[model samples]
Target: MLDLGITGVQWYARIPGTIGGAVFNNIHGGTHFISEVVKKVKVLDKDNKIRTLSGKALGLSYDKSRFHDFAEIILSVEFELFRGDAKRAKQVAFEWAKRKSLQPPRSAGCTFKNISNEDKERLDFPTTSAGYIIEHILKMSGYKIGGAKVSTSHHNFVVNDGDATAKDYTTLVKLIQKETKKKLDIDLVPEIIFLGEFWFGNVPGCQGGGVSSTPFEERVVWD
Candidate 1:
């Protein structure tokens, strides 16, 4: 969009979701969010009736929207954006694109939100760095369980090394959570949204890796 002189969507160029999904999750980067540009949204209610909602009716907020867990299907969205200098916008997009290109092509986004300054002080962590905790404290860079591994390129993500099952991902999540708690006494929460059943730990007659029929290695989509 920025290449065409659109500016509002520059912050979300890296997001892998559709327009509706972005609004549903209030997708954001730095100080900007999808809520800021959304003019309105159209959704299908449980009765399969179409409803037009004002931006405020969507109740968008920190990683949340009314459509979340409401079982409504987002049909479309309208955005209000302004014209900007294409040259300047392209420069910004290029910078963001450059930074995004550094992370794994396929991996969950940051495993956890950074601890707040107050939380950092309360936890006695020298700094509010979740990546620091994973790498410096847990020493888990490039660590793996099944097909899931901590990205050597970035400590905040778990890369699916092709053919990974949901179990592989969850197991890795558990490992990070477990290790962080054990080593730093701080609990790490995930930002990924699991769409289906996830298995953890050993269970009789159960294998946690939720393998798909065909494996794919593609641009990593972060949630």
Candidate 2:
């Protein structure tokens, strides 16, 4: 995965997916997610035919891609990058690492996407990070759903307090999403991919009728 600082351009190495999954998810890093950086993707179809998709052909938004609807496999991806200082990139990455360290270990990543800027402004909230919303809604510490609990250190993370099942984890996720929407009028989107069977099947629902589903494409986006 690539972490491209504030500039839109990034160079990536050490990622483990065939170019297909990357294109499908628009995999990216830092404050930016996958939708912003990808330029093109080469793919191999089910019949083993090779093709290249470029520009708008690769529909990307948030952590989603149009490739999710196709059965093609990705071979490689090309990304757009900007000229930038290496030192700044490293500094930004370091900051991200520090923030990530405060989250729960062995837990799914951020449980929701922050609301849009207009929505945040409407709510008079200083920021729209899902962690911030969850912290306010759940009150963070000591919150639990079966074997899953809100991280004492961070709200967006649902930690497995040992023996946690998919049900426990998913239940907590729904609860957080529900409460956040009720209080803030903003829907939260999940960042982590759910694997295997969940308590209510893959597309789990939130209180505000929001749903989180596994991306159709099955590929690793991180190294």
Candidate 3:
């Protein structure tokens, strides 16, 4: 894992996923997604031939990569970083942690990406943040669908609240997307990964529901 030592920036603030998942999801926080920082990617094709792609060779946008859509597995990734002070970096990280603590514990983090700045400005949107947009629509601390609830602290996050089922979460996400589009004419995409059978069964437009036939499951469990 390559650390860019990004400090005092909201890019690393409150995002709950990892570098690998961020790469896979095309997660863009403040300025740009991980794709923007990628210098090169080493890939193994179907025949197991090792190849390297750099610059525009690897097509990327929104939370997607051309290689990510395929069967290729990322052995490791390299990122561009700069020298910085450890103390200042720690201070930034601490502030971020404090801010994130205000969010619900059961959340998977932001549920959507903001529309482009041009569109937002045209709509007279107050904030480009997805959480801000949801808050405006709901006009409450939280919005509930069955056991799932849009977090009181942050709207973009749908919290499990102990009683939420996979179905509840999925339904709530759909509702958020529908509302956002209806009101703002912008589509909000999910940031959290729907794992296991849920991915195939729940995700729209995916072929053959109820998980991939592959045996592998990619998850991050920090001790």
Which candidate leads in TM-score? 1
True-vs-predicted CA distance for residue 86, candidate 3, Å? 5.6
* lDDT score, candidate 3: 0.65
**lDDT of model 2 at position 54:** 84
Query: Residue by residue across 25-112, what tens digits does model 1's lDDT show?
Result: 7988767888998988889998999999899898898677887547688899988998977787677667777777787877867767
* Stretches > 4 Å off in candidate 3: 1-18, 84-90, 195-223
Identify the superior model by TM-score, candidate 1 or candidate 2.
Answer: 1
CA-lDDT, candidates in order? 0.73, 0.63, 0.65
- The lowest-lDDT stretch of 10 consecutive residues in candidate 1 is 211-220
Model 2 residue 190 CA deviation in Å: 2.3
lDDT of 2 by residue, 7-81 (tens): 543332323355555566666655565556667778897788999888578678777776655667778777776
In model 2, residue pairs whose N, Cα or C atoms come closer than 3 Å (at least 3 residues apart or on different chains), thus clashing, are: 9-81, 9-82, 10-81, 20-74, 26-34, 112-189, 113-189
Number of the candidate with higher lDDT, 2 or 3:
3
TM-score of model 3 relative to the true fold? 0.73
Clash count (model 3, backbone only): 2
Q: Please give the clash total of every predicted structure, in order.
A: 4, 7, 2
